[model samples]
Target: MRSVYVFPGQGSQHKGMGAGLFEKFPELVAQADDVLGYSVEELCLRDPDRVLSQTRYTQPALYVVNSLTYLDRTTERGELPAAVAGHSLGEYCALFAAGAFDFATGLRLVAKRGELMSRAPKGAMAAVVNLDEERVREILTGLPFRNVDIANINARTQCILSGEYDELHDPRLRAAYTEAGARFVPLNVSAAFHSRCMTDVQQEFALHLAGFDLAELTLPVVANYTARPYPTKGYADHLAHQISGSVRWYESMSWLIAQGHRDFQEIGPGNVLTKLTAQILKDPLPVETAPAPQPAPAAVRARPRTELVFMYGGQGTQYHQMGRGLYDTDPVFRDAMDRCDAAHRATAGTSLLAAVHDDTRRGRPFDDILTSHAALYSIGYSLTEMLRAAGIHPDAVLGHSLGEYVAATAAGALSFEDGLRLVTRQARLLQERCPDGGMLSVLDSPDLYRSRRDLFGDIALAAVNYDRNFVVSGAGTRLAALQQALDAEGVITVRLPVRHAFHSALLDPIRPDFLALTRDVTVTTPRLPVHSSMLAGRLGTRHGWDEYLWDVIRRPVRFDELMASEFTAPGRHFFVDLSASGSFANFLKHGYAPALRGAPAINQFGNNSGTVRALRDELRRLAGV
Candidate 1:
């Protein structure tokens, strides 16, 4: 009575696959939407044919639906399998089911893998039936082209060849396979799967996987490349390399059979893997022999509890008139600001307090008050230090966009002086790279800009804040074109006051220089947990300050993902806004309503000592220390 769960790979996708599942399970839909930052239902059901078939959409969509199906099946009955395994793309689903990586990490990895795979040379795949594995390999070995190879060895008499289209069409190779008594059927696939053509992508994806923590599989999960159980260590690396390696499906099934596993359940869209398993088994049993399902965890009941505190702030939230009243009312805050101003002027060559308040440059705009790199850095330092002096400590810290440096300083990864210095230098370098172009905040979906490519063809949606809100930036003409297009659609677009296209591809030129500046800076690990907007998740031990700060400029700011992951933890409460104003706080309230569940009591400490004191009292009361 031994049983195992198996997952399917790329070609298992079809239109209208997960529509019914989303309808039946609304919570699963919401979870998938939050993780993907899009409408899961729209992607699964309503896509206009080819859109769903794209590599990026297809891989993630399949993974989501497959994982959800597994959940649903297991929840319906109370039976857990003794082991798990999957084909190429399905290997991630296996690891996720085994708890090696969480759902979000798995989704992100699959998405990135799909993106990299799409960039490979356009190729195709073919299924060779009624052929021995050794004979197919021998025939492929004599091929004239260097691109072709045996991709998936599904059964003893079946294998799939993946390579370039031209190589697949080679008369000599096709004739050799035909002569070897095999039936060849070409598959409708883009890019050669499980071939050396994917080597370049495999290398990069390995580095990405290094950032994740890979634990041993709790269940006996077979590997597609080695056709054996996963090793406790280096499973992530193994999975990455499996991309370009041959999928030993026959050998994997043999190993499972050796382990006394008879019944197999393929819990995903399509029965591709199940059919393959049947073909491989010596005596194919009825599909009814599949393992019984398992019951799900009890539904999480909504409870009103508040304990965790998330502090938010960053550089851009500073203003010239900020802390004017605080300086008069609170001596501690005034002294902290004074110290910050002196240190900042020494390193960044600017008076931060003057920039935030009483900027006497006539005819200058209000945004220009703290627009300088030095001014923003100094204000962030001063504000964070003021909070610390007022005795408020957060359980976790998240910074939005430029606020990461402030969060680093708060976490003790970067000293206040060093954080200010780095921020000032980084800001000045970015400003120098693009002096005129600015960013525009558009209150519309990024898909709108992507869909209507002709209207704002030149403009790039730099930041995807949420599904319906984004920040578009480029040259003035391009920005104007995009704004006009949105206006025509009855969407209001607001121009950001900053004078740089912050996250656009235009900043690519400046990244190398910025990386050079960060090379010599000392970056220590943070005392508290810090989530990165660049990586769209919590920072792992591998991501030190040096790597995080340098790449922050080049990578897209994934603040929306951060909010979704951080606030979803149970009993989490009190997001403390550490910036000069409540800009980020407002974003959280509106963008993350589902995660926060109706605003879990915000504490806006906008450069004021009274607000800081109240937050400190709340923390002390909650902690009871």
Candidate 2:
């Protein structure tokens, strides 16, 4: 069987993805660092700066890791594959591996491409699932809307639509796609990519492409623009055109499968293209006319003993505009958030509305205790409402430190109004009374921390996430020194974007005032089970919201212990990460459970709110509801 190496694009990148690949090829990593004018390894291994999610840095880092993986795999096999292909940004790696361009030249082009693309005008992209590209095009052509374009033909049933953000989110257009038997989901991207909106960047990138010397491919590497092997000449034009041209990923894979290449090897971080290949191969084109669009006939019961778990995260997960995708696209989410904003105003807290939805404040750091704390509660509560509105009611909910506040509200331990008031008031107390401090994420066992106490002696254990993952809390001023010390010992460390050292003695100053505020609060038994990270187990007692909320703030987060106690059959649980960045979901991914797929939540990456629709569809499909 012939084999083809495929690389994934953006949306595949994740923190801690390139753990050892950089060390395997130190020389290449060093060269990459030099060309990129930054430590690519540092960016990959521990992006303390949190800039990896940005398009400009994401591309270069992905290219290096993908290149390293390709090089490593081929070296072990002592041979190259028959052909190579990549999706979107991954195509650069395909070309580089095929000897079309040398390392530095390819890196330069990718870096420039990322920077240009990052600057593309604000627009949107949506994945239209369950519809063929032809049908999507036919629908778009018939719609009264204009400027929309297909960005990626991912599979026969999954194509990405891009254009002006407003036009893409238009209800008439979405209804057309849905009426035609498809799921229209607006992605989390901030710009119109691979559409005419990228024309400006494409022209600039063409100039950048002309500056580099290119070479003919030694191995067949299919192009994203034409979906075939590159011609001997004008490689620059083909590379540049894909900027504004739709990626022919499905067709490219089909051509390979047509040649009997069934053994496909995914060379990069994610299984995105791999999954697309399986889908494309599963439903090879000329699809029998899809039966007319059908509504789910009847609501069905969930599997016996099955559950929906709402998992929440604390700080370091908040970002400006985290839930803007849903706020713009989903009315239920928007309405909940509007109520949250009204609460924010009534409570005299910071403008929660402007902090998250205003485009002007998009890139600014939202790590302050005032903004992050309230934002976390707002997004978490509103997201839960959105999920529950879609019939995905949580059977159990878990919270990590500040997450417990929102979780309590979600679990009915406290009312929404009370939860919002308490969250905002607590933020005020922490910001005003608690001295500045920070937290550190160490990707090693707690045993490491115990063994290296001399170095981490000043820091307090904040949370034990999983087996090898733990966090430490310390003074804000000492955070830098602690990170440097860990670096000297070759320990992986990430300074979580938090200003207050939560769950530590540093917050002792605010305890008196904090408890005073919650003392008069009323509570009720949760309708569903509520797990507490501080308690390290299921919440107990029928009341005492004051003590519970205060203990959540002042105690260490024993996340793993709580999870371990609950660990059972994956089929019995659905762990949904409701944090802005999917922190809880990322923490649980360490377990590699099949149920993780069912807990669809937003992330810092592509199509943030798209996952919400994915969750609804999965629940509807599985439960027939």
* Full-model lDDT for every candidate: 0.67, 0.78
Model 1 stretches astray by more than 4 angstroms: 1-316, 359-371, 541-547, 597-625
For residues 220-295, could you state the per-residue lDDT of candidate 1 as single tens digits? 6778765667764545545765777678788788667765677989978899888878876784222222221211
The true-versus-predicted C-alpha distance at residue 597 of model 2, in Å, is: 5.9
Tens digit of per-residue lDDT, candidate 2, span 582-625: 77767766754453444547877758767887767766665655
Error of 2 at 111 (Å): 65
Span of ten consecutive residues with least summed lDDT in model 2 = 289-298
* Number of the predicted model whose TM-score against the real structure is largest: 1
Model 2 spans with C-alpha error above 4 angstroms: 1-305, 592-598
